[model samples]
Target chain A: MNETLNFSEHRMGKAIVLTLQGRFDAAIALPVKNRIRSLAEDGSRRIVVDLGKVSFVDSSGLGALVAALRYVSKDGGDVRLANMTVKIQQVFTLIRLDKVFKVYPDLESAVDSFEEY
Target chain B: MPGRQLEYSARFGPNLDNLILGADLVARFREETKVNIKTGDQIELAVGEALSNAINHAQAVGDDAIGLTMTVEDGMLTITVDDNGIGFLPDEVPQPNFKEHPSHGYGVFIIYEVMDSVSYDSQNGINTLTMKKRLEE
Candidate 1:
């Protein structure tokens, strides 16, 4: 298994799906935040982050997602999360972030939700 | 016979990359000790937060070494993270308002929520954060 955090992006209808793999923590938070910022600035109003393969996420990772939401919100866009593992879900629930971000069980649902955005 | 006690300890340089190394150590500890995956996940999360906080704080002061120790005994798991950086009062950190959805200040909060109890102390320029969780039989 790839130990380092990595991501890839692809267009799906009006939404941009960014799939993240490996651990998401302080080490890669800045770059991930920057990538999300660039995506929002580049006119992608609807962004979906796929965390299916992400094995871990700490506060720094959550902060990056929150920052992404704030950045896109400024552009009238929204950032959604998809496919969080049970552990990731637990962290989000513990911090009550589950109520802040629109989370979907799968990437397709996340991408599809953008139709209303 | 009394339950076997397990212990592990190590020190790492002040670097964010050590976060991963610390986590891997926890994973190995969990595997060797036969900790349940669910509890192990929480332990890893809490320890990761502690290590991250220490490493970041240590970087600000200087490249100091961070110490980590984990011990399991009597149905309890204890973790202690030590650093040479300036430490703050744990009680002083306000509980993050989930309503505000703030982008920062969630590290300590996460650690507190995951661990059963957390405490902080500083002595002679060394700061230590101790976290504990109850383990299931």
Candidate 2:
């Protein structure tokens, strides 16, 4: 089995876009965690995390979101999620984290929402 | 800490809440592994499910504490949890494959999807379960 959790960074206008693929479970913890942590290191405050490519996620994944949100939001910046798969979305609803994190349909709208806010 | 090894043992009491304890442990692993915070949350949930299964089925004692370990070598990571409960034949326990169960129901199936590798071995009254996945290419 492939051992790496796939992550890519981009920009939706001025917002940072993070795309994730593969299992976001305990087995692939550190790599996934460090990537998100460092993404917000720059001066950028508005961040968008897209889960369209993610196949599965558990509570640990949710905690990761909380951590990223906490990290970026410290300076009035926000971490929003977009393009979540159904299964992943279920995990979010189960724990009511969907409420805590702003979720959108796709990358475009999520970043656009950033402007609306 | 890319090639770090983490090990710890936890007790599983029948009345113990696996979700609570597993979540606590997985949370710490996130910092230990220093991976993506979001992925760490997923790991905690997966671990919680595994611990619950071990507590309820692996050992009759469910009251007995469970042992767990997470190790990172290179970019690969593995998490293992073991229990002293009466073990069952791996073949007998249903595989968590969507094709096998379809839409009837599937927890083990979901577990399999969320992780890259899942294995179990029961020997001498102890059952060891291991899950592995890669953090980066």
Candidate 3:
């Protein structure tokens, strides 16, 4: 019910790690969108969204994530999702988003996918 | 309204908690009404969408309770979600298309697609969204 979303920057060259917590509902969907927009605007193209801590994601929540993926990739950066739950993962698989988004088992590998970051 | 009526009601939080309870209500109604699987899923998703819409847009606080009611009459299921909060124009709310927008906007769209009938009425501080789905095999 009470989940927190956190943004962390690892100055490991060109990669940014964003950690999402709590529930991703319509209430906070816009905020997530704005955050991703800002990050992409700042030139942090290689982004890895850490969903290991995200507990719930409905259709709206998934929308925000999908939007983030599209926005971040537009400027030569890629977004990868990591540590998704079975319920959330099933949703992605159901909609075939798993194929569209790069999913990783852990943040380390997801971040390391930055072409030598 | 038919000669017979079956009803169930519950109050839940203004967040995702209401969503779970809403699903439960629909399941119970399906079991009692003995509706077909396709009809049951339609009713279940329609009611669920209405409850989610109430909780997401209307309720101000997390603990604020939304009342859900399901009516089965004339071989059809009617669900009503009532919230003691702000109301808006059902016409103004944009329709959600999963192919175009896989987001919260689709809740009402899903309701309309699955339900046989749908309407929203607001008066004296109560928002009532009623949806109906027919029994089919």
DockQ of every candidate: 0.67, 0.05, 0.14
Candidate 2, residue B10: the lDDT equals 58
Number of clashes recorded per candidate: 0, 28, 1
Question: Per-residue lDDT for A1-117 in model 3, tens only?
Answer: 234344444544356888887655555667887887788898888888888786555556677877887777677778788888765675455455765688999887787888664
Q: Where in model 3 is the C-alpha error above 4 Å?
A: A1-58, A61-65, A71-117, B1-4, B60-64, B97-104
Local distance difference test scores for all models: 0.86, 0.66, 0.69
Q: Which ten residues in a row have the lowest lDDT in candidate 1 chain B?
A: B56-65
Please report, as a value between 0 and 1, the fraction of native contacts recovered by candidate 3: 0.17
Candidate 3: residue B27 Cα off by (Å): 2.1
Candidate 3 lDDT (Cα, 0 to 1): 0.69
Show where candidate 1 strays beyond 4 Å: B58-64
> Residue B134 in candidate 1 has what lDDT?
85
Residue-level lDDT of model 2, residues A1-117, one tens digit each, is 322347888887878898888656444444555676787676778888888887656555566677667767777888889999777886676555755788898899999987865
Q: Give stretches of model 2 more than 4 Å off.
A: A1-4, B1-48, B51-81, B84-137
Q: In candidate 2, how many Å is residue A103 off?
A: 0.4
